[model samples]
Target chain A: MKKFTCIVCPISCSLAVQAEGGGDITVTGSKCDRGKAYAKDEYLAPKRVITTTVKIDGADIALLPVIGTAPVPKELLRTCLRHLYGIKVTAPVRMGDVIERDILGSGVDIVAARSAVIKKG
Target chain B: MREITADIAVVGGGPAGMSAALRACGLGAKTVLIERDAALGGILNQCVHDGFGLLRFKKQMSGSQYAQQFADAVYESSASVMTETTVLKLIPGECGSKAQSRQGLYTTGEKTGGALIRAGAVILAMGCRERPRQQAGIVGSRPAGVLTAGAVQKYINVEGYLPGRKAVILGSGDIGLIMARRMTLEGIDVAGVYEIMPSPGGLRRNVAQCLDDYDIPLRLSSTVTEVHGKKRVEGVTVADVDAARHPIPGTEVFVPCDLLVLSVGLIPENELSRDAGIEMDPVTGGPVLDNFMMASVPGFFAAGNVSAVFDLVDYVSDTGEAAAEGACRFLGGEALPEYVTVRAGDDVSFVLPGKIRRDLPSSALYMRVKRTIENAVLEILADGKPVYEKKHPIVTPPEMVTARFHESAGSGVPDAGGLTVRILGD
Candidate 1:
């Protein structure tokens, strides 16, 4: 049995999961249904949303913040960030503008968090 | 001199100030918000992290996205905002005098020649500042590479500059934990995060997501004893501390790093409040306020980090609304009743709103613990008589707890000597 803290809410329920080799698991100490689902997903396939900044050209600010539209595999987070660091976008981009699609074959698009306008000289 | 008059004046344009201004305008009071920065978002602009607005918005959002929601509301409201304008001085208003009505003076903009604002009420929402290396008592040669966690956030997230290839962070607070993850993402190697206390200072979720997820080690009962760089930070010396937090000799270990980030703590910005003759709570390091959020000065109010360091932005916004309502009531000539002093007792670090009104409706008392405890019961006593008690599985100093009390819960007990909140082991 492995112990984990459910991050679905501020309650932070401590869950104990016992997993068998044949794709079966038992969860204990969850106060709600969300905690159970969180434990199952965490044990089977953990995922997390990646938020980071990317360099921008021709903008008032030097970097623009971006985030993956969907949760990506936890193991591929570093790969996704490395790919993001290599790419640079231009200004006049909208908040939801897509910077990259299907990042690292994770089927998630990285989108801008805020609009950046070109600085007038 | 140019004079701008409004019913209510809000200082600072961060989450607290924006919410206060919006709530004041919603209460039908002409409100004016003054911001020193060029924009209204304040520090939220560079906070590009997620997990904000979880409680209030019911969904996780980025700091800028959460701030933009409030900023857009303020722009659509009737409140007038003055950006790039700094409030230089706050002159107390006349109170209980027949000659002139109560109106406070707000001097803004230029130092010598600036606009004067007279309002019926003033709300101090000026946020807190991070404790730097000097404040943390880290003896070292002054260098260019020493930076606060907030500064590094701005440099990387806003300016797109890699401060250094290797970094050593002192203090395991939220900012330090988040920055460790951020630096790791940018290809910077974080040596470790050292905390003097046995327990981490940041939230458990942050420890899990930011540190544990990134395979970063958290060194507890340890601290940075010295910085080892002259021109720029070349390294830092880490040492273990005894129970008394005294440095344990001969245990010093030196690690090489170019950047040293400090996330020690935050001090509430209360210079204006102190200058305005408001009584302050030594424990909170903020103004002593009553249940209505009114300071000792009759027409002056305070909220947000200016009132006390808060862990959550949602609570800051809540205080803003509460202070706004208090200001509205003051403007409507509703006199507050006598107050009952509230004190912190055993295992309790401090409590916000040092006093409570006799006729208050329902109020929440926010407090922190001095140390971590398990299976504890938090009790609220009135004159040594228990009025409220609640059980908790675990309590830590990093997270602030709130205890609610109704009007009939003896919070307004007449002739009550005092009210105290304490934590007792179960």
Candidate 2:
């Protein structure tokens, strides 16, 4: 048996999960369908979106914030952030511009979360 | 000093200010937005983490993304934006001298010198600031690495630098929890998070996702008592706190860390509002507002953190839109009606829009619970008679709950001299 808190909404339902072997699983204490689905996914293959900053050159700011286009495997978050930190981009980056495609083969693209304009001379 | 005139002048350029400016401008009012920062996004530029805009935009995104959406819209709109400008004073215009009681907004630009913006109405949207070390009651040495969670966020996300390799977070607020994950992801070693209260101060989702996911220990009823080392933070003394939140003398343990991040609490930035003589709510630490977000003074409106410290930015933007509408109406020569007082009853901390007028078809009231309640029923009574009620699975102090009183619910609420918002738990 495992316990989890549903993070899908503000309700924050506490879900109790019972699993038999690796096949049968039962989830209880969810008040809504979304919470139930979240519990199932959380118990199975947990995924999370990554939001981090990467180095940027010739921009007004030293760093540009980025977000993963899709939720990747939870364990791959560090690897994705490390890869993003190692890479640098020039100024004039627009929001939603892809910075890295298929990051760590997680099928998640790292896109610029905010625009970085060129520094004024 | 240079002089500029507009129909409405909005203070602050964060989510609330931007939304208010956009709404006021969209309604064909000449609006001027004044921001203190070089950019219009304000603190959201440092808040790179996701989980924002779920209610406003209907899409969960990063704070920067949420802010940029409004920034882009403001830029595209006809509203005039003045960045890197500081508001010196808010001078109320003489009554009957100008239509709708105009105001003089004295401001100083970064490079363009001083200016006085004369507008018919003003919107106060300056956001809140995090409480610092002194306010948190920690007896510590002055150390270099001691910084607020927001400062650390700025250092890592905006400046691209880590504050320290090992860190100890003092509060379990949402920012502290998020920073624990953020610092850990940035290769910093988070020793643990020590919270003074038995329960966490932030939302449950943050405790699960930020602390639990990272294997970070959250020690409840524990606090950082003292700081050690000089120049930089070398360690901190963690102590077990009693029910009264006093440090137990014999239970002190020293935790070695180079960084101490403080996420104690947030107080609404209301210096301008306070100095302008607007009545404030002692509980909320913001201005006392009517249903339309109007403060005590005529033609002066308050919204966002300046009105109250909202749990979500969506509510902040919501109040911004409402305040803008009120300002527009004031400019259109509409008089404010009499407002009935709304009191916070049993198990309730505080309620916003402390008063409401009878004429509005609907009004939204935001409040927080004094403590945790299971199977909670929120009841709104009009002069001791129940008029509106809502049921919630659970209610906690960390999360703000909202209830709306619509005309469809009942009609006697508007005329009631007093209303009480309370939580009934079974």
Candidate 3:
């Protein structure tokens, strides 16, 4: 049996999972149905990414977020950072504003996490 | 400015607000519920979970079902509910105002603009929100698949879209824990929940119910130090942390995953409250209230999650009732003495009901701890006396500690003294 913890909502469930014969797995201990679903996937595959701010021009603030809308592959973080280093946004950014959709065709969108105004001089 | 008057005005149409309005109307107050949303239910609309009404209803209920019942109860009441209306400000009522009585509200905004409904009382029931990823210092290759736990839940439950198949999550908060199970149910790959604390930030039942039940590994005192990917996420570098919380060298390992969900923590929604000059308690991110749940400004009352994040809906409702009554009592000319003052003590993260009047009955003090302890004693001291103390077999930061007092200790005059809570005998 494998163990996993669901930290989604306040109902953190300590899950117990057992792989059956094939890709099928038995899950228990989830506070809700979502926990079970989380268990099956962890054993099969896992992925995630980092979301942060990038420098912007002609805005009140010098930085805006490029939050990940999807998880990128695990090995190419440095490569992605190099690309972001060369990127910059113009002023008047809104929270949740999409910066790049299907970024690099990774099926993810980089969005602003918070709103910032272009400072009036 | 416009003038309007109601017996009771409840801000926020969430569960607490709706329940408060329903209760107030049932108590013979003509209630008016003002919701900023197009609908009455606030965050509950996005919360599609099932463990919502367990304590309030003594039965299992989905978030939507519980919201419907509360909405129905409010509908049945004589209280008037105005949706998509924002309460911009509160002021002295016209004509009725003099030194003896203060005008309660001069409201402005799209929904209830230019209307002054003299609410005999008011209840503030604003809710909380999630902290974003950038604050967590999760460095990674710029790509996608990172989102707050709440957003993921809303996207799947409300918008009916799948975020991704593979996933990794940072922070083992309740939302993250539950979503782990949620995404997994949709046949998506759920990676793991990582926590920087030695213990889980969520309730123990959640650790047991959500993660333990599903076989998801919880890396305690660990973190997602780096994200790996180019156009998309390919993996994450998770490392164990020592007591100081710095990642232990040589312990770094890479895990491949697609989606990352964060459930770091919640902060009270206080932008409006702050702008209104309400005195706030930094510890709880809420406001300082006397026994009546009234803020520094008269007629400006706060309750429920807006005041502080509550573990159960029952407490939210309980606080909401007090806010309404406090507002009404003030308007009705009931004399409530001012508390000398309130203060937070050592071992105590913070306490609610920051003050109490001499005439007011002793109130409930809600707080949490700074860390975990075994065989701990939570002691409440008033006027330097051991007013109340309780020993628990165990105490953790995630679970809130609640202690109430109804009897006055000495002069019954709060201004004459003060109170403090300390943890001992661990």
Best by lDDT: 2
Q: What is the TM-score of candidate 3? A: 0.73
Question: Each model's number of backbone clashes?
Answer: 0, 0, 93
C-alpha lDDT of residue A50 in model 3: 31
Model 2 chain A weakest 10-residue run by lDDT = A76-85
> What order do you get sorting by DockQ, best first?
2, 1, 3
- State the lDDT of candidate 2 residue by residue for B209-326, as single tens digits: 9998889999999999999988888999999999999999999999999999998988999999888888989999998988888898888998888777787988999999999998
**What order do candidates take by TM-score, descending?**
2, 1, 3
The runs of at least 3 residues in candidate 3 whose Cα sits more than 4 Å from the true structure, single-residue gaps closed, are A1-121, B1-3, B88-120, B139-142, B408-415
Docking class of 3: incorrect
Runs with alpha carbons beyond 4 Å of true place in candidate 2: B94-96, B411-413
Q: For candidate 3, what is the interface RMSD?
A: 13.3
DockQ of each: 0.55, 0.84, 0.05
Tens-digit per-residue lDDT, B1-426, candidate 1: 778778899999999999999999999999999988766877788888888887798877787776777888998999999987888778777532421235555565653247777888999999998997888887657977889999999888887788999999899888899899999988899999999989888888788878877889999999888888789889988999999998899999999999999999888998888888888888888888987788988888888888888888888888999899999988888767888888998999998888988777777788999987878899988878888889987788888888886658764473456678999986
lDDT of 3 by residue, B298-406 (tens): 7778888889887766677778777777776776776677575556676778778878765666577777778777678877666777767787765678877777765
TM-score of each: 0.93, 0.98, 0.73
Count backbone overlaps in model 3.
93
Q: Is candidate 1 or candidate 2 better by DockQ?
A: 2
